[model samples]
Target chain A: MRVLGVDPGLTRCGVGVVEGVAGRPLTMLGVGVVRTPADADIGHRLVAIERGLEEWLDTHRPELVAVERVFSQHNVRTVMGTAQASAVAMLCAARRGIPVALHTPSEVKAAVTGSGRADKAQVGAMVTRLLRLAAPPRPADAADALALAICHIWRAPAQNRLQRAVAAQHAQNAPKGRTA
Target chain B: MRVLGVDPGLTRCGVGVVEGVAGRPLTMLGVGVVRTPADADIGHRLVAIERGLEEWLDTHRPELVAVERVFSQHNVRTVMGTAQASAVAMLCAARRGIPVALHTPSEVKAAVTGSGRADKAQVGAMVTRLLRLAAPPRPADAADALALAICHIWRAPAQNRLQRAVAAQHAQNAPKGRTA
Candidate 1:
């Protein structure tokens, strides 16, 4: 199974993809970050995010996408940005009909490091160890994204089966006529 | 003199313009957030930011631009992205040969309120009250941008002096080789 994970942000978004077989060590696929101007208008940044995800998706064609599920926001601006970023990721996956899954920050952290409150450094270290990388991912966000992917690769079921199950659940419970 | 403040991001960016004088309580020339797709390409997003800022600058013809300065980051990924975003803002201002000022988040918060430790909501409330608006800027980042503009206006010298200063400073700090 191949899995792609993303750490969403308005300016800098980290992305990582991993491939492996069930009950076997996962292999590295690809990783990078999509960036936009923090001082540019929001519309511009959104396009950057969309294009970044599209480039990665087109290049990798991973079977699944694992993203950080957006939560509540005290900063409406930050929250809105996060939501928009999430949408872009979803749209990228939807375009190819690829399956997408979301995990909370805590869940990914817990799965990777045995603790939900692990710091970025700790998470980076763990992600490096899990992926058996020669070095830890350079940026904390990139490390976090790698860890999220590892978390899913170690937990997500095999390709068609896992995606189908989640899709069914989401469809059954999805609100009627409400936009994604 | 109306001033437009921009807090740029890849997803949702904050933009606010203030008109009138500093002590006299400026008019809220305008305020809004631009939304971008999260998964969009970073390059496209940057273009969007540039276009949007250019359009706003043309429409408002604000006397000055105030942008947030990014601090150092251990994650080169985020740092690089932020740097790129900030550069776009500077470029937009420079293209118009309009004077641009930058402030750190702390400085912006401090200038808006009495405390640099002020949170987003506090700053938003203060900006709204400072302008005597009907509501707080829904997105705190936009309010913060406006606050930054207001702060710059409050700190800038009189119109005659500012115009003279821009002329003298223009020689040494011109837009050439601005991207570092």
Candidate 2:
């Protein structure tokens, strides 16, 4: 499966694309940051972000988009901007019929670095090792985006298994020939 | 000027359109809520908001859009949703080339009533009075949206004066005839 991960922010939105499945090697399709001027009006900033994301979506056309789930416990100002940016990212994907998945920062870190509490450098190092890149992606946001994609790709199998088990349980609970 | 006011929210996005100048009695073109099911996914909710806002814009073609400014000091979860919804509202306006304005809750309340800390009922009462309606708009959110449009209309003259004053000051300070 191909996935595009977004580390959403107003000033610099990090985007990365990875193609592969669980229990197999992954390929880094692309990585970049969409930067908007801090001095621009919020409306214009959102429009710019939308255009940038649309370009990424058109070029990569990933089957799924993974966005870093925003939490309110962070710095209040930063959290609002992040939430706004993520909304634009999700809107762009959903408008085009692409599925969007949200994974928390801790989830991304834990998926790649073996611990949710892993530091930035640790996550970067592991992403580099997993992707077999000579150097880690620059601007921690970029590396974080890659880590998010890797996490989504790796976690899909377990999530599917859990979903199937739940479905099977529901099916067993129902009477036969109830299907309409 | 015609203004479309948006009180952004996840479940019920309140919207109102008002037309007229500050000194003149304003006309209420429309007032309603754009609702998305609370159980809907965030992306789908945002998309729904976008569609709703676009329809309002298409119908009214307001010269300006007045949206409530989101602050992070409020309930974290609610604030995040508000911010996301506001982003979509602003995006719709900006994408259509309509000027976007943000009014804080305090500012809107103050503009409608005499106090910045006016309660919902007070604001609703004032909105009803100003619009010359027999009854206040139902749903506090709807009233609040009308109040926002009213606030922007009332504040525009003062804002324009301030802008002109600043521009004159700059022109005086600027080097003469560098127009080449």
TM-scores of chain B, in order? 0.85, 0.88
Best by lDDT: 2
Model 1, span B101-171: residue lDDT tens: 77778888888888989998999898989999999987777887788888877767575257536634653
Of the true interface contacts, the fraction found in model 1 is 0.00
Q: How many angstroms is residue B19 displaced in model 2 relative to the true structure, after the best TM-score fit?
A: 0.7
Question: Which regions of candidate 1 are displaced past 4 Å?
Answer: A73-75, A158-160, A164-180, B1-180
Candidate 1 lDDT, tens digit per residue, A1-180? 778899888877889998885578778888888888898645345556766777788788787788887654345456446655665665456435566777889999998899999888889888788788999887777887788788887765655486767555544653311121
lDDT of 2 by residue, A1-180 (tens): 788999999999999999999999999999989999998778778888888898998899887789999998879889888999999998887665566789999999889998999999999899899998999998889999999999999988666355345434533653322111
Superposed on all Cα atoms, the candidates' RMSDs to the truth, in angstroms, are: 10.7, 8.8
How close to the true structure is residue B7 of candidate 2, measured as C-alpha lDDT? 98
**Candidate 2 wrongly placed segments (more than 4 Å):** A158-180, B158-180
Judge candidate 2 at residue B112 and give its lDDT.
94
